[model samples]
Target chain A: MSAPLFEKIALVGIGLIGSSLARVIRRERLAGEIAIATRSPATLARAEELGLGDSYSTEAATAVANADLVIVSVPVGSSGAVAAEIAPALKPGAIVTDVGSTKRSVIAQMQPLLPGNVHFIPGHPLAGTEKSGPDAGFADLFENRWCIFTPLPDTDPQALERLSEFWRRCGANIDTMDADHHDMVLAIVSHLPHIIAYNIVGTADDLETVTKSEVIKYSASGFRDFTRLAASDPTMWRDVCLHNKDAILEMLARFSEDLASLQRAIRWGDGEKLFDMFTRTRAVRRSIIDAGQEIDVPDFGRQVVEHPGAVMPAAKS
Target chain B: MSAPLFEKIALVGIGLIGSSLARVIRRERLAGEIAIATRSPATLARAEELGLGDSYSTEAATAVANADLVIVSVPVGSSGAVAAEIAPALKPGAIVTDVGSTKRSVIAQMQPLLPGNVHFIPGHPLAGTEKSGPDAGFADLFENRWCIFTPLPDTDPQALERLSEFWRRCGANIDTMDADHHDMVLAIVSHLPHIIAYNIVGTADDLETVTKSEVIKYSASGFRDFTRLAASDPTMWRDVCLHNKDAILEMLARFSEDLASLQRAIRWGDGEKLFDMFTRTRAVRRSIIDAGQEIDVPDFGRQVVEHPGAVMPAAKS
Candidate 1:
């Protein structure tokens, strides 16, 4: 590359999102030097062992000093703390951003702390697996994903475009919406799914008649799909639920009401109503697959061997 | 291979499960001849085109005339009608079984119609993908999966052994339980998950504030996993809910109660409660992955290269 995008980039709280950003940035030569920082000393040591950055520090202020860009990638609840820590050390023209899931609360928490000289654009990458930690991240985590920016009204256009280009280089498509709309949209799309998955798995776990082993053995029937979402980082999800309370509660209320209606249809033996809802939902999945939002890998095992073989794979797990 | 397990096998209802069973039977040399039948002429034609069986017919009686094994794979609501049509033609020693998701209802609907001369073992293979129809089937769908049998009190031991042997040959582990117990177990494991998935997807579809396109585009953010389970055949699920009403309603009520508590936790900003629930649920996914009951495929796009590359891929879908 002729020159790196920034002379130095400071990453705060190097967890899954943070480390993934580091990998993509290094892969694309997006920064001349990478500075990593986290609250935990053990995590900072792990980042160093992973060769994640050009410099490692346990102190956020030490990491952000003289850096052109600072990205806070901790849980949403920690946004304000990091912003306050790095505010005095931020360079005059540095652009400060975050990769939190909830936008409105993050904006409310962090905006008041950052100085007027820096651009504080709240963002969320509509990406990630349920797995977490530094090891769980990879350079392509954001590939073909959406990164939504909820820029405050006073945000600098040039700074916003610059951040957008950075995410684009990191293999994500970018969009912009206000903080409130972002929270509402995400409550239905992301928050509700995780809550439902966690709830169902917990319910299954607590069943006295149906042993836990039984649930685990027959999970592939339908229960296993929810488990993946339920296995997400607990701390991150707790923060999202706490920060986006109103929007999530709104979505959960609607979800519970819809489920009540479905339960009534089943109790009353209304096959027509049940069939209609199930049929309508199938169309949405088709649209998601058609929109290229899903992998469409075919959940069942692939039948290989064109001519002849055992229907089952030869090797058992 | 060793003198086919049975002289001939007849499959009624050539959908995903039926086609998959036919493929597995042929691969394992479990039958000398295969006969397929369905109420829909188009489905029978498609099954014939796919070479799913040696013979095809629209009449269930004709298909089961000389068959040693008769598998009814139709929707649960149609179980009684199929049993009535084939009861007269079933061979004296033939084993008649079903693969319906609900056990008690299938037994109740089919048992009285059939003669005591033939064995009626109600069975369900805990396997399937969301897609339906003959074209969507693969032989390996039931590999390492559970095939549960709900046998009547007077069912012949030899007939049960023969059918169990056939399922083992098809690469499934088998277990037997009473019909009522099977229904209750399945209501929590299979029926509830599908209902919740269908309900959430329906809620998303009916939302006026959040556009459908937005949900579809950002579905990789966790919602797409639910969509896979929700997209299952509508006719099949409608029958399941109607047939397993009491058990399903019980599980749904428990699920709703757990969800309401979770909603309150989020509303009251009880991060500790949220964290505890989210953490406990993660262990269940671990058990599922360990039990070899699920393929723990990571959800996001994999990181293909480690070094460096352009943000955009060469191929665009």
Candidate 2:
């Protein structure tokens, strides 16, 4: 479609994010040679079977050899190890980046290990579904999604712009911020939501009076919405909770305090208070839709989209 | 197409659920005549514009004067008033039902006010979108969703069966349980989720560090899932919290306790513990999908379905 942006690009950790990158890079002709690497032999074989990349390897070092760009897509906890493995093999001018949820931890884990000759950038693409693994990825996974880059103070502007261009080509809008600010923003918007979802699901599962069958059967009322976030990859979330500890803890405390106030309002039968709180949160959803971050239809338009012609719109008189 | 189930059916409160009932009743030819009633003249006029009913009235008594079936779809707090208004005009052998989230309170509010000759069955069709009002309704809102009826001990079997048949024709499966058990079950499955969602969004909104712009920009990461529930009808949710106070308090207590333990796990960096909790919750989602209560596609298949041909599924070798 267009000239390849790089002579070669290596993708480490061929999970949902990595596999999606491979698909997009291939479709857009972003790389002349796409190399994919993962620790799991089965996953590597599966990637090769799907023809996701020009070369597949179980070793990260072998995959990144002579690569003009190296993108690591793994759990936050494994960032350091992958950085150590690929550091020596990376080309001098290669741009290295990551797709971990937490940016500060990723930077701390990989910055020192990466060779000084290469430009290292910590990034998080705020996009994914509950599903995981190589097969779960699709080429349009990052379409219209925000991919935030928390670059180092001494980071090369030219290299940063190049990587931004690369992500823009993959159908992502780019935003840059400080690593600490990125963690705080994500704590409220991403980490805390996932934690709350997992906690609620666990609570529902552990209930003695309410049968599990009943919970599942009647989930459409509201509980099913939380289940989607709770079903995300356990290993990935564990790393996130561990890596972004300070910001996540701060958010949890604030959330618990707010819950206490809400609980008290309910106990006192403060209908006005409850109604006020419930009414204000609605404007945020409206803002998100207006900003194009969310779908504009009701219930994410699942009912209408899932079964076309099943739901007829209101009649015109 | 089929024999009319009722000679005249009166729908009180022409909002999301009521309007949906109107659409489905007309589509399935379930009612010979559909009369719509609401306290709000604007909503009644809108329903009339949409041709959702054969006749429209502002007074519940006028709408149900000779109707064989009357369905009240209003906030739980208004159930008693509606019951009082329509008690004198209810037909001798009519069946009356209300679709409210809190069943025990609805029974307490309306059971004594309703006329003795009429069969009053307190029902809750566990179906809705975040959006409300008559214009938001579609014919398939109840399709494949559950409709739980908490009938009184002296409820007539024929009345219950006829009402269940009406719901089945509207494409909902029927379940019956004691009013108390229904409250407890719904506290966990529905009320708590909405309360927690509302609380978290409130927390995010109240934050001083993270800008509102940042939260909306990054909402797709996970926060947007909670926003859908938080954006629900405030008056309806407030009424639910007030009416189902005891059961909701119990569930909220359990949710907070569970959340505290999860916070501790994250603070202590217990990856194994965090991983286990996150992994177990995934099964609940799977069971929900298997039970036919939820869609099987990822992210409710929003991205794929919204932009058909935008996403190419993983290549098959």
Candidate 3:
């Protein structure tokens, strides 16, 4: 095996992403000493029980002391608080980073709190499941996924490269973009989708005619997919919405406008328009499959991923 | 192995569901002979290539002739045509059924044309994937899923019991509901979700600010879930919308009303309302998990079905 990437790595906020990183780092022997910290005493105890780190503490400041690298995997809204808590204790030249979905907000919240001696790079690993908490993490969570970093101007390039290599070892391909661009992109792709999922699921729950049993019974059709996303960590998503407000609202506005148009088409029975839009979206799924972003399901549950191209339908025009 | 349930079974329209039934029938020895037919010669040839049946034909009449049981699994729009085509050829006392998403319409379109001598029981196997065509099918597709049959008033109880047993051997529990109730239940659980997914994916595809590459790059958040549903069979879905117009429109109206309320909450920053709705929906997912309807994800890629009550979250008040 290759040499350990750092002598010590401190992971603040031992949630899904953090614990997953901890598991992968331990499995790969990428860090000599692992320090885990979270605000909740129960969660901290759970992390200790899982043996996810060499050291565990409820104090963020204590966890980052003398660590060569510190990863703050808290919600975007909590980034500033965690950064403030650990700033006085961070070792000089320590590469400080975060794994928040919204990049710009996290950078805005965290960058000002960290000491100038430490490198503050905002990163988001484009991977996760609907599950949350320490026990919800696994070593292979980042495999074949993208880890994007948004570095500020005047940032140390070497530190950036080192962090990139760190994520690569954790089984993620690295990409860099400006923080604002990352927020806008994620708003369209991730945040908006979660918001819509939560909305639709809420809609189903509020229905007067449709019972919950019926929804669960017939969910194999399409509702089940949204349920998985809607079932995500509520606290994390609530923080995401509040932190990435502008971008999410913008995306939501655009989505509403497009939905209005679709509603019009459906009301008018414009099959051609519906067919055209539906046909175009099929290609994006193909592109994602080609990019290895998702598993190809011939039928969602029946056909396993035996052959790559065999599972997806032929790309429709 | 058990004795064949039917002397000969004819599947008229060998697509995803049809071919899956064919495979399951063969695997369980449910039929002594299988005849597959579709309007498209190419699909028929493909079904033949997959060895989905003992006989393959493009003519529906030819396929159903002399068959003890005939299952018409086609797009909802084609039910009338298929019914007319096969009506004269059906054997006396044969059991005929369909596996269509929209049952009321299928019954409305098909029942009059089918020979009265045959027991015309319309059914909907509430299972499917985004993928279609003969190659997308497997023998285990219906395992542990629900199959709802909306039998006509004059339908024979013996024929109904026999069909229920057949579905049981194919790994499904059967429920009987009126066609209208089935349509209403599915409208909320299935149709609305598909429509919403198609709408969101189309919205993302048409975005001017968020580039296509950006959507694909960061889709792991929640948008990717919608993409799977959006990538469903367009022809089949289009027919569903047209046939089940009233139910779908009613459900869509409810969804839009709830969405408007959600949008207002977001706009007004009503955290309490948002939290309440989000919290309530989380319980629904827990119930679904408890009912053995979903797989638990440690992370998104790694999925396993947990034992009942193993992963149940705390119930929301």
Candidate 4:
């Protein structure tokens, strides 16, 4: 491993992203001494049992004490509390950052509480699965994924580059953007999709005419795709909805308007209109696949059922 | 190969589902002879090149002339036209079936046209990927997947059993249900999900607020899941929406209502309500996984980027 990037690095949350960060830090030797802290004792003990850090504590302030860098990976809603708790304990010239879905709200919550001598940069890693908790994390979670920083205007350039270098060591490509712009981009790509998935799955469950068992049995057809996103962490998503309220509502309104028009087309037996919309959206998936955001699966990458007597090359997803 | 189950089997409209059926039948030696037909001459030529059949034709009538079993696998909207074209050529005691998502409409369209001497059975396999056309199919597409039949009340029991046996030989589990019930169940499990996916992807694409490139780049966070469903065969999905208008509309309405409440919760900053909704949806995903319809993946079976220092066995999806 290369020389340590920071003398001491504090991770203020030990859930999926936090634990993944800790794993990557240890793997790449990014920190000389790693400090892990979480509110729950069981989770802190689990982190210790996993040997993810050199030091551990339940108090956020204790974890950040004398740390050259502190990374907060909590739900966006708790940013203010964590910031207030750790503010007084942060070392001067320390680089403080967060991994939260929404950027603007996080900045609003943390910027005032953070000491003036410290660097406050807001960041979000555009990678994750539906899983949560420390055990759900893995070492390569951020590999080849984008980690975006919504740095404040007054942020130190050297501190930003140092953090960027740290994320680069964790195998992520980095991009910087304004906080409001980051929030809007994330609202469409992340927050709205989760809300919509949750809503549709809930609707399917509450159907009076169709039994839940049938829905569960045949979900492979389409509905199961939505469930993956719907199964994401409840607290994190709840916080996302509450913090990213305006942008999420805007996306929801547009999505519903588009859906109503689609409904009308179906109602009128407008096959041509339906076909056009269906066909148009296909190009978007192709673009995403072309850009490497999606895997190149001929199907939805259901490799288990694909080894049949067909002439096409097997896509062993 | 095993002994042929039928003297001959005819497949019309050689797209993903139809071609998969052809591959399975040929692999299992389910038919003495295979006759493939499609409206498109180019598609017929491609199927011939792929060795998907013993005989190829552009005429559905000619393909089914002396066949003991004919599986019409066209778009749902074309069910009536196909029935009208092949009605006179069907032999007495022959079994007729169509694999369509909307059973009631397919039955309503084909029943009146088919000869009374022929047994008309409606079947839908609850399996498919986003891929379409002959080249996208494989032999094991139906393996361990459900194939539901909405048979006519006056249908011959022996013919239904024979058709069911053919599917069983193709590695499918079979069930019988009312056509109306099949339509309603499928509206939730299949149709609405596709529609919602199409709508969301379309909305993201049409956004003046967010660039298309940005959406594509960040899609992995959540939007990419919906893109898979939206990338499904347009002609077939269009037909599904048009054919199952009532059920699709009903499901859309319910989905929209639930989504409205979710939007309200976000707008009003109702954290508890949002948390409850998000938490409840996770159980639906668990049930789907437990029922063996979905894999137990933290994500949508994406095994890559999961090497985050965990000891869990690799999910090589």
Candidate 5:
């Protein structure tokens, strides 16, 4: 299929993103050979058992050897260690990148350790589900999604273009922004939402007045939506909160301030203010739908999707 | 199907819930006649055009006259006014019930205004989407959902049983709790989540560092989930906020307190604490899935649901 893009590609930390990349690359024939690596022997063994790669190893250095393209998909907190482990074996002129959620922290952690001969273009793919690990990934995980690259000022244009083409072939559109701006953007969109979700679920769990069984029973109302985000990989999220501390803290402060104002409105019975705020936020969802970032169906199409052949409301009569 | 549950059933509001009730009642042949009423002439006209009822009126009193059963499905704030208007017109021995989020408020507003000859019961169906209005309803909206009834202590048992049967035929399981307990339960499960969603969306919208467009574009990462709840009907949510102020504020206070502690953990880079909280929340989602309250698919099955032929990751290689 249009010739392999790279002779050899190495994927480090074969979790959801890494395994999905392996599947998509194989499907598109993007790489002539695939090498997989993770710190855990069990995960590496699972990857080999699933036939995800031509070669598998628990040693990151071994996987990076002779690889023309290397992707690091470890937790943000482990970026430095992975970079240190793989730097000595990376082939000359190989293009290296990552799918970390936080750009600045990852760049800060990896840039100095990576050999200057390799092109280290920092990236964050704005795609994924609440689930993680090798088995949770799907070949089309990046379909119609955005894969943002935060390239350094002195980065090579040719290497950046090649990486962009690679992501495009994997079914993701590309955007390039400065690393700080990327962190700030992701802090609000990804990090803050996950943190808030985890906190709210914790709050619901700690309730003495309402039983856990009751919360679980009636969660279809709205609380269940947060549970998906809350159920994400704890190690990954813990790393995110630790790595992107400033931006996340800033967004959290703003969120708390706004929540205080909303609490006050409820306390004062300010229907007008509550209505105005609720109405304004509705337009945001509409904009997201128009932008093709979300499904147009109600409740994310859960009812119809979960129960195929269920009667459509309009057709019931 | 079976013999009609009532000779005539009156609906005093024609919004999403009311219209859905009309459609379901017609589908099951649960009523000999369906009378629909709404304060908005436009909505009433639309309901008639949709063929959702046997008769339509702008006057709640006219709609309830001579009806064997009456269901009030209006914003919580309008419950008292509708109760007052229809009390004189309700047939003797008629079962009158309301579907409001806050049970105590609806009981307070409707109980004293009703005649002693009629049976007054309060109910809340825990089903709906972010959509509203007459056209946004379907017959199956209540299927497999919870329809909670908070009957007054002195309520007629036979009437309550009949009402329970009606909701069951409409495709909902029934639960009964005290008015105060129902409010508290819903405050944590429903009201708090909506308020948090509205607040978070407002916070993101007001951000200066992160543009609104950026937020919308990257929303799939996590922010979009909150927007669905934020996109719910404004008047309904506002009324819920005002009418259920005490329970909502109490839940909101607990949420904020929990959030503050989570914030401290992040600010201090307490990875152990963050990971523990995140891990603990994962089990709650599992409990929800195990209870058959949620779908087992990852990402709420959005990827496959939105694009039917998309490759499953396991099938790709």
Candidate 6:
């Protein structure tokens, strides 16, 4: 293996993303020493028990001391608080980054709190499972996913390159965009979908005529797909919505408008309109596949591998 | 391995579900002879070229003649017409079934046209990919999926058992439910999801600020999942919406109400409410995973895999 990417790395908030990073860093020897910290004492204890770091602490300032690199993987709402806690202890010229889903809000929240000497680049790794917590992480979680960075105007180029290199070794392709652009892109791609999913699942749950058990049993249709996204970390997504308010609301308004039109088409029995919209949307799936952003499961067997707790009897071959 | 389940089995359509059933029946030797018929001459010719049937015909009446089982796999709108066409030729005591997604509509449309002598059993296999056409099917599509049969009152128990046996041979577990109940269940489980997916994809497609390429490029987050369901056969889905209007409208109303509430929560910055709703939805996904309906991709790789053409590349591992 090549030499470690950083002499010492500090991780704030060792949840699914943080723990996964720890595992990958350990597996690939990406860090000489790993220091882990989380706001929750119980989570910190769990991380210690899992041996996810060389040192464990509840104090973010202590964790960042002497660290060459620091990653904040908490909910977007907590980025500022963590940055404030670690700002004083951050070593001069240390590269600092975050893995929040929304970029502009995170940058706004963290930039003012961080020391001027350190690189405070905001990023989002376009990857995650529905499961959270320290135990719900794996080494390959970042493999083949996109990691987008939104650096500030005065951000050091050398620091940005080093952070990009770190993500590259973590099995991601790097893309850089302005914070607002990233927020808008993610609002359409990620936020809106999750919001829609949460809405639909809640709808099904609130049904009086159709029982929940029936929905669960017959979910093989299309509902099951949305459930996976709907099941994402509640705290993180809640913060995302609150933090990226304008972009999400804009996308939601657009989505609601389009949905009203579709509802009209269905109500009016306009087959051609429905068919055209359905046909056009299919090409996007093909493009995503070509980009290598997902796996092809001929059957449900492959799904169990990615979610170990999701084991089911194999279909009789 | 076992005696052919039927001396002759006629398939009245050759689309995705129809062709998949034909392939499985052929592979399992569940029929001594397979006769395929569809409204379109081009599709009929293609099925013959693909060797999806032992005999091919354009006329539904001719195809059902002397057949012990006739499986009508046409769109729901055409169910009554096909039943009318084949009623006179259906052999005495023969089991007539369908693979329509909306059971109540299929039953309502077909029952009146069929002769009392023929056993008209409406069934639906809860298995399909987004792709359509005879070329999109495979022999193992039905394996481990549920095939629901909605039998009318006074329907022959022996015929029902025999049809269930046929589905079992095709590698599906048999489920029996009333047509109305099945329609309501599917409205929530299958129909609404597809409608929502189609609506959202249309919404993304019509965005003025976000380019289509940008949506496709970053779809790995959540939008790609919706595209898979939206990419389903337009004609089939359109027919389903028209035929199963009441149930779908009911579900849509409930969905819209729930969405309004979620929108209110987001607008008011009600983090607790958002967090609770998001948290509750997570368990349903777990139930779906427990029921073996979906695969769980880690933090980054959660793309839909229903259409072969839409299979995204697996993230770099």
The candidate that achieves the highest lDDT relative to the unseen native structure: 2
lDDT of 3 by residue, A1-317 (tens): 65699999999999899999999999999999999999899999999999999999999999999999999998777888898899999999999999999887888888888899989888999889887899989887887678989999978999999999999989888888898888888888888888888888888887777687888766767787787778888878877877778887888888878877776777777878877777788888876655556556443332332222222222111
lDDT of 4 by residue, A47-139 (tens): 999999999999999999999999999999999999999999999999999999999899999999888999999999998989999998888
Model 2: which residue pairs collide? Answer: none
Q: Can you rank all candidates by TM-score, best first?
A: 5, 2, 1, 4, 6, 3
lDDT of 6 by residue, A171-201 (tens): 8889889999999989999999999999999
lDDT of all predictions, in order shown?
0.88, 0.91, 0.83, 0.88, 0.90, 0.84
> Residues A204-267, candidate 5, lDDT per residue (tens digit)?
9999989999998888888989999999999999999999999999999999999899898888
> How accurate locally is residue A122 in candidate 5, as Cα lDDT from 0 to 100?
94
- Interface RMSD per candidate (angstroms): 5.5, 6.9, 10.0, 7.3, 5.9, 3.8
User: Model 4, which residues run further than 4 Å from truth?
Assistant: A305-317, B303-317
TM-score of chain A of 3: 0.94
Give the poorly placed runs of model 1, Cα more than 4 Å off. A300-317, B300-317
Q: Could you give candidate 4's per-residue lDDT for residues B251-270 as a string of tens digits?
A: 98899888888888888889
Tens digit of per-residue lDDT, candidate 1, span B134-179: 9877788888889999988898899999999999888888988888
- The order of the candidates by DockQ, greatest first, is 6, 1, 5, 4, 2, 3
Candidate 2 chain A vs. true chain A: TM-score? Answer: 0.96
Candidate 5 yields a Cα-based lDDT of: 0.90
lDDT per residue as tens, model 1, A1-317: 38988899999988889999999999999999999999898988999999999999999999999999999999999988998899999999999999999998999899998899988888999989887878777898888789999999999999999999999899888989999999999999999999999999999999987888889888878888899899999999999999999999999989998988888898899889988888989899878767766645466222222212212223333
Docking class of 4: medium
Model 6 agreement with the true structure over B36-60: per-residue lDDT tens digits:
9998999999999999999989999
Clashing pairs in 1: none
Q: For candidate 3, what is the DockQ-based docking class?
A: acceptable
DockQ of each: 0.54, 0.50, 0.30, 0.50, 0.52, 0.54
Clash numbers, per candidate: 0, 0, 1, 6, 1, 9
TM-score of each: 0.96, 0.96, 0.92, 0.95, 0.96, 0.93
Q: What's the TM-score of chain B for every model shown?
A: 0.94, 0.95, 0.94, 0.94, 0.95, 0.94
